[model samples]
Target: MRQLRRLVLMAVCSTLVVASPTRSLAREGVTQQVHEARQEGSVWTAFAFNRHLSPFSLNVDVEGSVATLTGTVENEVKRELAEQVALGIDGIETVDNRIRVDPGVRPRLVSVAAVDERLDDATVEARVKSKLLWNTRTEGLDIGVESREGLVTLSGESASAQARELAGKLAASTEGVERVDNAIRVTGEPGTVARAQSEVAQAGNLLGDAWITGRVKTRFLSSDNLGALDISVRTDEGVVHLAGTVATAAEKELAVETARNVRGVLDVQAASLKVAG
Candidate 1:
């Protein structure tokens, strides 16, 4: 009986040893599948958020670090754009772009539930943040901006109540923003705003004139108070020239002030920015 018990114990140990490796292999396979699924999802989300690529029906497949794109676009430029966007995703080392460029292909109608409209939210957040950064009064304040749909929420610490109010105004002035929820706290800390401003100024000095011009244009485009397409922005050295037709004297004045506050702008020449009749 003792010998029989010993044999049974040995058999049990052998079974466990064999099952352990099989279980490990199964777990590894599942992990790999999950990783691939995540990669596919990331690629899909990137395509969905891009305005240029969103309208077209695109498909993404991922294996390991390689992403395969299959879709039909109107032109070759869009096909290349799809590939580049896929390459931008993290962990994607290679993109096999199998997209066909058929000039006759039309964009499919996407259902609202199928795609979350976070692109507009993202644009609103960026515009609000840029406005705050370009505004002299609120540029130095620690302001956190968040947007959901058209509603914007501001949170952070401010050195003064005026700064907090200014931050909210800047956010509200951004185009596409429907409401502003100002949650900024006033600390009344001396030199806090000044110190932050100094740091921002130092960083701004390193930016190129072209970069400054582009930023100014982007700000104008997102501003509710300005007509971006009507305005011409040109930066020379550190000076900005504005030649455009605005609705009122107040708008022209606002335009000048807006350009002047942008970092790296030494001066704004807006004599030619005439008010419309």
Candidate 2:
């Protein structure tokens, strides 16, 4: 009778353990802990004291592994910098930066600091160069930086269009930078001629469609929000097809929206992009 009772008790305990859903609870607890820790760290307060980010009015919202930045910054460079800073923090998976640009603030800021003389062109140039060298994004590229007065220019060959854009951003984010002129050219792949021939033959008489496709690609390449590195675009008549993997659902949505908004795009067909793991 005792053996029978012991067997029943063991079965009951096993059933209870199987039904507990402990894994889900553990995941939720970890996420909550990380969220609380980030809040305690005072991320926004740190932003205000950062040299590159200090000029902006910043607000930070931490949700799960994503950090969304909202507020106004003096320029596009500051806006990008705000996102970069948020992304640098631990446990952040994505940065949704929506910082408004107020270009008018630049002249007023320059005038306010006029009492302490401006950073010399050489000093500004050196600073920009050092930042570019240190930045992992543009460091590997053999780009050149030059500054005159307050305007900075970047010229050289980059491996990809993203590299060119990153180089420009690095220069613009420097303390004394007024403006950046990015003239960096993207080097073509070894099979460029064959690829161009294949494309021309495949789309023989659809010259207008080809032009529209080129325009869409250029727009994607130019945007700070969208990275066209892995995205491939094609056009047929007025219909555009987009295929590629993106970092998140947000990036996929932005790419499709951008393609659809183009002047000559009548329809956009985008396959479900695989989100990064």
Candidate 3:
């Protein structure tokens, strides 16, 4: 009887030991499946938001850190674009692009909701407004900006004809703006300069030196005339310092004007900026 009882207890212990690891492994497998699903969802959402890849109904599959893309695009360029976008996502170490390049494959008509379209337009409008507010030439002017499908419309009042034209130029130069319809009326307002000064005074207290410097550098980077030029910008207490090499004297002058136009710039010291040989 004693031997039989000991044998039964040993069998039960052996069964429990084997079952524990099996249960643990089952849990681990589930966790891995969930992680891969989330990664796949992330890649799918990214493709949906991307302008170039959104039109195509691309399928994404993720395994561990690799994402596999399969779809049909109009050309090879778009197929490559899709791969690049997938690789851009975090945790996606590699992209296996199996997209077919069929010239006959037209982009599917992906119907974007009206709300999404409006959101895009709102983003463009905000960008234009920010550009105007940051620019010294257009800041403090009563300008209204609206955007729809990359078309920008400008209205309100300007103090001078030059201001009105500058507003238009700034809007046209913006990234999403396809065309600008400038309807700003020149009111010959006397307080334009004063209002500008007052706005700057208020901004001076809030705008840090680093913020001013960054804006100045960004302006240089975006300017077609200055983007290629090597320019260095620094700011201290609303005063900006510019240093770099420019090909021509006119370029140097334009650089100075650009720096001066940034809001919160109390003065510009450009003596260090020199013309190239």
Candidate 4:
């Protein structure tokens, strides 16, 4: 019985999952027909997104090769990480971010309030503390005020946007504040919005500049002994390798010429082309 259980467990564990549709866009095919078939427009993305994801409350949506993600996450870093994984797919064009942030998400900014003690010493500390404490918005601000001569300096991390923005105003308005140096860092999390934009920009470069225009179409094309299925183009440096299908022997020759003439191309490998009657 023990031996049988062990064998069954091994059998179940050894099963390798293959052909998951989620990342299939990474598969290689150079022909126009192949690209058209493999290019998942919208439906495949929408159906596949929720199939696997983190258990967090953030919501992600997909439509027509564009993915839109929403909902709130506990931490800012998790929000950015999730977006990175989704954009790794080849076919994705855009990502719309509508995700809300948690309370902790507002702390990306830091504020340092400093004062020159040469103005007023004794009441300056009390006065700064009173001002900070009185402001309802700065409750989460970790404050430190120091006085030399007569100036009061304040420093702390603001809790939210309003807090960081108002730190200078709040400090300068205080009674004993003579010169306020507000060093609050306003850093919004590099969440989906920032990352998605960067990825789209990168993809634009890839689509625009690769040496091989990929199974390109030509005005007057020809070939020789080229198989229509051998559309794979391998490039040795700047030289293009043509593989796959062709309609006639003329097409094989035409393809090699077409590849040779493409801008920045060095040469062509038309060996894989097969022409038929």
Instruction: Highest TM-score: give the candidate number.
Output: 1
lDDT of 1 by residue, 1-277 (tens): 4345446545643554587886345435434544554455556656765668888988877778889999899999999999999898778999989999999998866543334444445445655765565445665566777778789999999888778887887788777799999999999843323223332222223223444565566567567787344888777757899997888898888888888887658899998888889
- For candidate 2, write residues 166-197 as lDDT tens digits: 67876787767888999989994321111122
User: Tens digits of per-residue lDDT for model 4 on 1-277?
Assistant: 4345446534432331144343223222112212222222112222222212233444444445666777666666656655665576466567675666575643222111111111133234434543444344543356665545545465666555566656566566655467766665544322111112222222222221122332232212123333233465554445676777677776677677766776546567777776665
List ranges where model 1 is wrong by over 4 Å. 1-19, 109-114, 117-277
lDDT of 2 at 220: 75
Judging by lDDT, tell me the better candidate of 2 and 4. 2
Superposition TM-score, candidate 2 onto the true structure? 0.28
Local distance difference test values of all predictions, in order: 0.68, 0.60, 0.68, 0.44
The segments of candidate 2 whose C-alpha lies over 4 angstroms from its true place after superposition are 1-42, 105-277
Q: How close is candidate 1 to the true structure, as a TM-score?
A: 0.36
Which of the two candidates, 3 or 4, achieves a greater lDDT against the reference? Answer: 3
Please, what's the RMSD in Å of model 3? 25.2
**In candidate 4, which residue ranges exceed 4 Å CA deviation?**
1-211, 215-230
Predict model 3's lDDT versus the native.
Answer: 0.68
Per-candidate clashes come to 0, 0, 1, 46
- Model 2 backbone overlap count: 0
